[model samples]
Target chain A: MGPVPDRPATSSRTPADRPATASGPGRVLIAVYAIFAVAATSRAAVQIATRFDEAPVPYALSAFAAVVYVLATFALARTGPTWWRVALVSCSVEMTGVLVVGTLSVFDRAAFPDATVWSNFGMGYLFIPLVLPVIGLLWLRRTRPA
Target chain B: MITGYAIAVAACAAGVAIWAFVLVVLHREPEKPLLMGVGALEALLAVQVVISVVMLIGGGEPGSMLTFLAYLVGSLLVLPLGTVWALAERTRSSTAILGILCLTVPVLLLRMVEVWGGASA
Candidate 1:
């Protein structure tokens, strides 16, 4: 291979110049992820601080969901294969968390006396929590490199 | 919580959401008028935040003061942050972010009102 052309500095690049996950509808996904991150983190923080003893499982799950959202949002906003893998893992975990928590919360109400971001498959969130990960996974697949 | 004011804020937010989606349907960017609408809604939200602060200072309480305060900050910041994110992309979907934020503000507002009611109870 001939000498590679001089690489432009990374700092000046726009989202348009980055990965597919940073453009168009992907940005909208990022916005949604951000909202959930903020909502879940704050909710979990308050729950844990105020009443951890009352319901540790659900509150802890909220924090975990918030972290996954945060990770996915950050990964999608950045460029590179590493971040892509991170985003994929985060979304997978999010999907599993919602399904498992949702199922358990429904059949075993005593276990989740309190609600979580994933309780009832995110029914409280209009099922966005349940729906978002599936969409995210699809988007990731659509944008994947050959 | 200011009962009538809360209603007004929620209505205004819903109105903004509808307006943003209309822009999307028309294939238009967020125009100045739409931004102004958000600005007006932001001012109304500010009033709600002010009332909350006053309540706390005047020995009023919320069921969970921490939760209430966090929602107050989150509700106020959504519009500004969403606006920035929209402008960053400058695409049709960018405009959609405004709609999402507009929708979120009302939910946040409703939660705040509920928290305030809890405190008063």
Candidate 2:
């Protein structure tokens, strides 16, 4: 109806004065997203390189999670609506991935011989992986276009 | 690795709890003294890295030397990187970041310890 809510705040600013990083809660979210990107990427790299045969499914999932985190970090950090949509897409995917992977890993341990980023509901990573998307969604809602 | 990691973990637990109280509960940024404290922690982590490396060279290598090396290097870098990142914000958020990093370093250190201690002890 009204151009969809949560329009990006950075969209209106001139290129010269436009802020580099997201502001306030957005900044915090970006930081978390960035951390996850680094952590997941590195973990996947190690897992796949050292022991690909250990658990193909979980390792692949780890790589997937890493991509989502990377995209979310970039989207959250970039300015304008394009990046906002990117962030939303990646965050949604991340949430779904964690939920599905978390549940499956628990119900079917055989499927996950080794732990991925989303394994055990990300318990190894302090459950931050589970909580992060929920927070990201909330932050997105709050910053939605008026 | 065990001794250094134990000290690191203890320090991080204390540091993060304090910062969490200050930032989340009190809603304030860390003062100069807190920053200095982090610096102290960083020094300890540097020392840990040295100890771990020595142990590794002395024939106590982990199962995966590469991963262990990466974690060792990462743990050492956390405090300095965190301090820089937090200083830019200079707000309650920054302090929270510091706390989180502090907490993370110890966890990383613990993992490093376990990896080394588990294998070639």
Candidate 3:
């Protein structure tokens, strides 16, 4: 219920001096990434647990995407320079994952009978899965160390 | 069912309106009143969860009980989490977070309804 401790109320301290707690657009972005991590992991778990026979490739992709999302969320929420580097790497990987998975899903429909988070550029996810990484990377860039 | 659908639609519309207001008009942090409105939506979602459970108990179970339940739970979760996350920021970005979660809820709810209705029918 309290305001994020990381940010002083209208203070002029630098990002390093600020607490590591997420705030502002960072809060929103973390929320989104956290949601996706939960969603993708849960979906993959259910699919794999209940009917792994349905589509193994897509299911595995879902699990992989879920892990990336988890890492990216953590990295973005962290305040230090090391975490910033981690976020940059994860976002780049995420962007590549979406592109590769989207193109492969299109060219090789036989491999993806069921959809994964990255399938068809996250078409089932309104392409947000694809777009999120670009936005995340941009946000990181905007907040990067000078 | 009709009322639920209507409410979901209304929630989505309200979310868009709030986003517009936040991004354009207010240019301020997320106000308490608007947060209360989102709280109201969360309460409605809680009602929807209860209704869904009741419907399942009343001989309206979906084919994939597990998946259906997961979605039902997921739809219920987004609001409170979004609310808290936005509360932390209390800024336009927070409002944007609320908007995103609001938009996501209806989509998930509709999907749950579809899965439920499809299996039952």
Candidate 4:
């Protein structure tokens, strides 16, 4: 086996040299994003596969949200101007999706007999869906390349 | 889904999460004690997977076998993966990541219970 790598010094390199979008506190953010990516994707897959006919609107919305999450997670982890644009667009769309779905679910309960991840502003998810994009946008702005 | 074991896992996960939170607040890197706590929780989760699989083999019918098994595997993966991710960047945020990882275990457990035919609101 390879030698055990040094843990602290190598890992704690100064943030100036690291890509701002995925360094330090941003790592934690990315971790959270990754969790959401996996969760949403699996949920949408299961919902679509098992009961799409029962609630096609909400299940399709779930699939769309899952795709957005996967894209956002990918863009956030990568480095490049193109990836930055991708992240920005995905986060913006996510914000809009959550807000629109949230409101529609509330006023049009008949439309969503089953809950998508964004229903009621992601109430089932402790509102992380509603909040994550705000944080993502702020992180992107703060980490914009000079 | 054994309610007692699920509660135990939840309690231990909560403890580990609190420990991770304390490390983050102090601006300390993840250390041995935290890793040990995670290990303990991982052990519990391993047992949970074994018991669940055995029960399934013994004809316990969950609402959806695939979802239940997915959650079981996910619970096993979270800690070790999070620890690797945290160690890859030993910073305050890394500890926060561990906290997030620990917090997710209880959520997974709850989902497992729900998929195993428990009540869901």
Top lDDT prediction, candidate number: 4
Worst 10 residues of 4 chain A by lDDT: A1-10
Residues B8-82, candidate 2: write the lDDT tens digits: 556765765576556545666667767777887777777777887787778885867878887887777767866
Candidate 3 lDDT score at position B34: 64
Docking class of 4: acceptable
Docking quality tier of candidate 2? Answer: incorrect
Candidates 1 and 4 compared: the better one by TM-score is 4
- The sequence of per-residue lDDT tens digits that candidate 4 reaches over residues A1-146 is 12222233454332454444666777887889889988998888888887789989899999999999999988887776688789999999999999999999999999999888899999999999999999999988866654
Per-residue lDDT of A15-134 in model 3, one digit per residue for the tens? 554433255567777888988899889888888898888788788888999899999998987777789899899999999999999999999999988888899999998898988998
Residue A4 in candidate 3, Cα distance off native in Å: 16
Tell me the tens digit of each residue's lDDT in model 1 across B7-65.
88899999999998887777666678888998999999999989878878999788778
Question: Considering summed lDDT, which 10 consecutive residues are worst modelled in model 3 chain B?
Answer: B20-29
**Per-residue lDDT tens digits of candidate 3, residues B35-56?**
6777777777777778878878
Give candidate 1's total backbone clashes: 0
What would the per-residue lDDT of candidate 2 be over residues A1-146, giving only the tens digit for each residue?
11212224433433554433365446666767877787788888888888888688788889999999999988887767677788888989999999999999999999997888898899988899999999988877655543
lDDT of each: 0.83, 0.73, 0.75, 0.84
lDDT-wise, the better of 2 and 3 is 3
lDDT of 2 at A95: 92
lDDT per residue (tens digit) for residues A44-101 in model 1? 8888887899888788888999899999999988766687789999999999999999
Over 4 Å off, model 1: A1-19, B119-121
